[model samples]
Target: MTTTADPPQPDDAGAPETDPPAPPAGAEDPATSFTRQRATRWLEPHLLLRMSLRAVVSAILGEYNDKRELMGEIEADGFLDLSTPDGDLWIDYVADLGDGFAATYAVATLLSRPELEVAPQGGTTHSTRQGRLLVLGGDECYPAAHVDEYENRLVGPYRAALPRKDPDAPCLQAVPGNHDWYDGLTAFMRTFCQGRWIGGWRSRQARSYFATKLSAGWWLWGVDIQFDTYLDEAQLSYFRRIAEELRPGDAVLLCTGKPSWVAATDDDVEAYATLDFFEREVIHPRHARVRLALTGDRHHYSRYGASDGAQKITAGGGGAFLSATHHLPETIHVPPPRSRARSKSRSTTYQRCDVYPEAGDSRRLSRGILRLPFATPTFAALLGGVYALLTLAVGAALRDPAHGLVEDVHAMAAALRGADVGRLAGGLADSVAAFLLCAVVIGGAVAFTRDASRRRGRITGLVHGLLHLTLLIVVIRGATWLTAGMPGTWSLALVVPLVFAVGGILAAELVALYLLVVDRLFGINSNELFAGQAIPDRRNFLRLRLQPDGTLTVYPIGVRRVPRDWDLRPGWVPGDRERFAPVDGIVAPFLIEEPIPIPRTAPGTAA
Candidate 1:
């Protein structure tokens, strides 16, 4: 099929600056006006200042986090067998994708890479063969999985990424992620099922889940495992038949959307159990050799191998925020693995791909020798709330000097110095009561929000309230700290930098919270936030090849940001620059896994 120059793209320039219906009029109560105003002050736009401040914030706290990129395992001493047209199957897979133009940039980079694309005269008598298959892991678009988002975010960007179609076009296939199911798979079916062309590629699978025929001995299974899923009876039957149809030496590569065993604060045992079930019932029962299982929910790369001979690979880095490897809790296996499993202690990957020159175990470990406290927003919220109390105390001292809380506190301090035990005890009781009263007032404010009963509404209220409360307190306490001693002493001068540093941290937290509410809560889809505080920022994907010799090689590709000279003018938004484009433009390369030789299976028996 001939491909044309991509048509005009969506222009969000004139579209309403605000969307998702803008919280409806009267949603913001008049009583909360003060809090909203405070929010605006800290989060108001001044791009350069925000950038400068974020640079400082990252420098201070970024080191607190590090990742193991799994590069050596993927690269494996450079024995890539990358000589294309080797009469082998080439598959490029990505998941949780379609965030912005950066994903498109990643697609473009893959298409442009020599290893992924086949050259003329290398294969086929007609000299018209491409060595790659376009596989979508899931989540085609952000916000909701709607038609407009697919066209604007996915289709348009894809067309721009690879403008010309290969004469022998690569087939497109997608496994729907949770976001895709939000709209009942309407957009996904319309785009991928109806034979509609996305750029030059087309989806060939009739159902959401599909098992494709690759080399004679290799088969690929992409299951829907729909939202919070277990494979429905029909899906199970479909796969079971595929299993029955395969020969004895056939090997399987399983692909799903969410990671199986990430020990998140809210780990989904049922979800993992579902995958585990699919393995035991759908695949293992049929006696096919299982080589690798692939998933892409968290936006980073991880590879896990077990003593049971099962390997798990996560390559969610399609185009989302980076996932923090250090913060990820231990992997929790369902049924708790009754035996002594030393899986966690034996991970063979440690090199992270982001900020390449500064990547790798030794460098990152050296940079993050000591932990940085309060790097997360939860800590910021606590500090912010404390700062508020201190400010109220100081203000009361100034406004009503004769009968002020600060005066009472100072009197108590002096009494303690003079051994006035009774007076000190009374002052402490009064202070405790006042603190309780403040908590009640803040809780009332959170409860008063109009949408407090909606999904995550109450949590949002509490988190936001605490965050704002913390924001205010930080400013107040920081000011007080900077001026604790008047001009005569050098203490104030010495404390100035610390005060500014505190201010910077608070500023960073505010910025993070604002984006969280806008991008996730009020916007469209939401990621798993820890204590609803911080959003991880890793975007990545994977490239896999099953050679004729039965060696399976995996390459986990990460897209840190958009490369220089990419045109995002197609679907421009106000915050698009900051969202998709970054100045430092630090990006990591593919974290390769060492190739594994697939073990043969006995006839009608597990491998």
Candidate 2:
């Protein structure tokens, strides 16, 4: 287990290395250990209300999907040229974006922060600011990538949060994530491909991918990969034109919606292979090298590299649930340095931030649990065990011994003591039937809670049912053995059966609780089949500056030691759209900037 600490800096920049023999993989990164100190909160009853009005609007826009001709021809007029007034290109990159209002609202606040805002603010010593190009990594909205969802979840919140750029309006561009393709890129194109007004910003790109020209031999090459399933002859041809435009020794900054080959646990090959294909098929053919590659998905800050000094970063912290910093495969993980709070917002309870997920819910639940530091299962199981014991003691006193049910229990005691196995079955019928009650309790708990805008609830009734049966068996055998001393009739029915039944239920809950806690530490399974890592609760972004001669300096900004901006008003409609402000309060206090040095290589146009 690697504890979260200051990230390492290469002593001197050199060529990126080939995949080296990795250290043994282990669970629990530093962030996981730090989160253990989190305090318990009696959560306010969460009551999520359906936004019928938003639904009505979405229904109206559904017809637009058929009008591809009107949204305009699939534009691939590749690349936009903006002047480098200061000889530096600044772009703010965020991905896994488009949660509800609060989520986008928070990011907009970062964009609108006084420090980032163009106008000079008083009392600020440093004059560093935000980017001219706003690039989205992917996954623009949640549930399913419908047009209506984009309006309320993405366009509306961002519009309300950021003031529009004009004349020299900062350019906005995006590549779709898996969720965006859920609708076959229908909504994604309309919102982003149109290159007009979207959430008060102007889209400048013509296609899902772009080859932008930056100054001094630096270029930005972003591609769609189209879910890694849609790349075609036309896409390859588009890059061929880009390659023709490039000079020898020119370096490229690559952007994709997904991160692959960065971790040992990453089993997906589409994106990873797409990258390889691009490098061999397009980049190498042009004699250009990918200097830096950035991606979203896996919502945290992580960096890895190849044998040629090239680097890849996973900076999906835009506004999704924080991923488990602890669970990152030990292979290429980089921890960030701890920071002192300049000023912070009043701490609020931890709130789940993931609304748009690329995979199944069971995986979502597992990942969400992993992001939290607390070993909730141990404590939760303790509580369940106490409740089990108490339920037995209290339930016994409430029952009248003369009742037939109670009397049968008394007979059950006699058989149990006498080893009268045949008689015991008949006496225990009611108690055995009552075991279903344990399943019922577990099923109900699983059904009631959920996250917003995700494709499905993390926990489900059926999932709990299976879990109940498995845990019940353990309880039954354990309870049977523990109560070996049923010496009398009174002990078997009134005392023993009650204790055994309640104890068994509570014991089952304890086991379930353990699964929930461990899921965060070592995210394995989900409530749903085919789940992936538990989603994390971090909100971060990357700032990259392309140096004149192709060397790139990267500053990865992290939000805080522990997130406290989890306060959201009731209702799916974030009515407080006007209230979204800089995260955790104060200017630039929460962001930790760790500069990575890129090796300066000889500059020339490759033949």
Candidate 3:
């Protein structure tokens, strides 16, 4: 295998090389360290409701205001162009970050460093300098895109990491993801479109999408495919103009928000189809080859290299909750068989080359789903509340409300212990309100299925709902029996809390079991499965070097664990090493694999 070996690491006088100096001693140490935050607990009750509401409102509002179309009217002319004054250049790329502080800052801290010495497998240690250009692949901030969310989650962490201005700061550019589209690109535009400063990095792009000319014959194209929608007319026209600058045999680096190649492998062809159409209509017409495609929506690192040495990589592990990699396809055919006739792009089979966390580790981490209650306490609490309501409804249906509380409990317990199905049915039939409540609970369970859009998903959801209903009946009966000998009003107190606490856990476990079953049987709900676990480790990013000889070397960096505590640097000023330092010391990054080298010309190219 070819490798980009690190050059010798010594000055002419034989002095050992080192990264730039740490923050100056004059910098003050605040009374407290910045408390690190965890990855977004997506299964949390309040967050879920809020996100769902935003998604719905955004969808409805988006119909009237297409941000991409509006972008055309305001976009600046000409593509972003970069020169290689030193005959070589470095670029940093990360995506799917800004969910939590600790993980996001961990990655940011690394990126902000002037240089990193990484120990690659089977190779000598080497120092890689920071990129001159920083490309945020997508999903810059998580949960949703809002002014406050961007500041706290995305900008704040980055500002804290770098925390100072520089004369030669890297240029920042981005492509919007679904989360950024939650606010209909309002927050995204504010953050990236203004050519402002985000930390020491300066934003240069004036639109959600960008095309950059890197070096003599290489280009970086960042497309904004809003919510996996079509290539809007305005965006396409912009790229078409950029295409005019392309020369035959030139190479392009395509950056997109989603790994449409992976989606195509999963039988979702439309996503890749959009990308295919863009390449066929825009890039190919110029006779330029897309040497590599990069993306970051999957929250892990996966690379698929075609026979011609062209590569597609997904490096989403900037932050956010770690997504499972066990389910990724081993190989995929670009332009998938169905969409071939629509484009002149030739078909190529790309095989999965390297993956972070390894498939075995991914499978092992998945078992974390079994700890659902602890992983997502709010979710369990929501279930507990549901169970409490169901129990009260059962009590009202079986016992006389006119009686005292203790007497009612005794009567309800007696009816439940008797296991008299006919009497139970008669009581339920007589109480219209109680019956309706039961119907709603069951209906909710069925509706909660992640894959509810498909028949199997509906069936799985119905099974999950019935399982919760059964657990409710068992918990009510068990709780009443346990409190049988308690004093007056004591059983009432013990029973409700027990149902709420214990019942909630049991119901959540059922959800975990449901996720496991569905994933194993039908290959669905993997997102929900790992989102509940919210693993904070296994984050990664890419550093690419463009040599004057037209050779591109890619370094895949991985962080197995992010620091949880940070020491704040007060009174820090520009040119300072960093504003906050990790308490456990900065985690040294390692190469997930050897640096991949893609030549300017590969097999079956325009040349």
Candidate 4:
């Protein structure tokens, strides 16, 4: 009986006699479940409110000129490198016109390399040793029709990097961007047209929109997309006539500022849809050798194809401010389709494509080789990180030994002692002055940090601003210390407090700005105001709502009126009643109880 009882007593190594009860379905442990639900409920509305406020602030402050000084400095330094391995082929320049206005310009002789060869589909590659290079795109600067501006911004760069044009090279052909129409293509036609001279007459110059054939068998058709609208009746007729005249082996290279089906505004998209008209009426009917379209307004490179085998290539980043980031569509149609393989930075690099004839196959497609400097966001982030780390390390290493870290502390104390003091009262006054100076330095730093975090649009901007503000405070404090003439040596105690005070002031200012401008004006309700998480959409309209049950609902406002064409839509409206689960997982009504006021003050107004 004793042995049996001992055996029945549970042994440490044996399995438990009974298993713990399983958690109920859709339920978690009390501590963990409560924490998760709390987090989700708190974060959802807060983020939305914060983003709405940021957008409103950006819209209001966008017109301010707070960075005029910075702009001037950038302009003076010419903030870009325009050199190539071959030599300086382009002069990139930025001009500050004062009051926050600036213009960027670049010039380069973009000549096709004669020695380069292009291989056609189904044919052996052949070299074009000395063929004339044609200017496939820009021949003149637009909008700023002033001869001086054009000469400085456009002609100068090309002349500086002027490639030796082969005497027997083909005459350059050209297309015009939106800017060309600002002056009605007058200057462009005067510079490039070889036929009837248009002279100073605007109407005659505008006639440059007319089409002309560059070679006998190969037709270079120029189409003027006015405001990125569809081709006019005359242009369409001209294209049709040219299509009819094209022989079986002849190729038509179409030039325009805007590609036929690339992303653009509704009006522009509608206009380019007319390319379909061309494809059905002319391209497919003729079944020509090669139908190539080239454009440059995007300021980036891309290749697309129409269903009828029409190839479209965008070579817009020709020494201009690079286009915004682009994403390739899922269903792009090209003869030999290519997809975007990598992400890239906003760059000013230019691309050069070399085309050559293949030896064996006459029915082969043309080969294109693109040359441009590659860039990536990762590279930029790495460079910025290195710079920041180096700065911090250098600053830390350069501290004064007497003060434990700060070199100027002792000198500052000494300066305070040397101040002219006729009596005990005067000496006290000098001491007080020294203390106030320290306070100012501290206050400035706090203000800077607070402002910086609130204005966190770009990481680089935040880092640069914080570093600069801190340095300013440091220099000011050091100068004040030197002038005061006191007797005490530098001490870590004093230095630490001073640095802390400065940082605190900066942070406070930023917080204050966020609360006053961002939160109040933009209706940002975060955990600070309402105990919940926040969600924000930077590109949409503002929206925020506090719920009856203590939770807040925040999102973009004005949904019904949001154009169907818009890529994104804000979630809320004034009268509509709907419920939405915010990013933080809090569910609340979509519409807010009250309307938020939009400030008329421009962006950077506070700055």
Candidate 4 C-alpha error for residue 278, in Å: 3.3
| Model 2 agreement with the true structure over 149-193: per-residue lDDT tens digits | 776667765655543434455677787776676666667766775
lDDT of 3 by residue, 1-607 (tens): 1111111121222222432333433243222223345578888999988999998988866666878787777525566667566558899999999888878988998999879888777787767889988999999988889877887787877877775556566888899988998988888887887656677687767678887878757899999988787888899988898888888888999999999988877857655888888988898888888899999889899999987788999999898888888888888987777664555366679999989889889878888899999878889999999888766666667764557766876665554545444554455445777677667766876666666257877787777776777777778767877887875357666888999999999989988988887887777888988888888789999999998877788999999888777776666654465667678756768999888998777865544
Query: Sorted on TM-score, highest at the top, how do the candidates line up?
Result: 3, 2, 1, 4
Count: clashes, candidate 2: 26
TM-score of each: 0.55, 0.58, 0.89, 0.35
Error of 4 at 34 (Å): 72
Clash count per candidate: 19, 26, 0, 54
| Candidate 2 lDDT score relative to the true structure | 0.50
- C-alpha RMSD of each candidate structure in angstroms: 15.4, 16.7, 7.9, 31.6
Q: Which lDDT value does model 2 have at 39?
A: 18
Best by TM-score: 3
lDDT of 4 by residue, 5-40 (tens): 001111222323433232222231111111111011
Cα-based lDDT for every prediction: 0.47, 0.50, 0.79, 0.31
Ranking by lDDT: 3, 2, 1, 4
Q: How close is candidate 1 to the true structure, as a TM-score?
A: 0.55
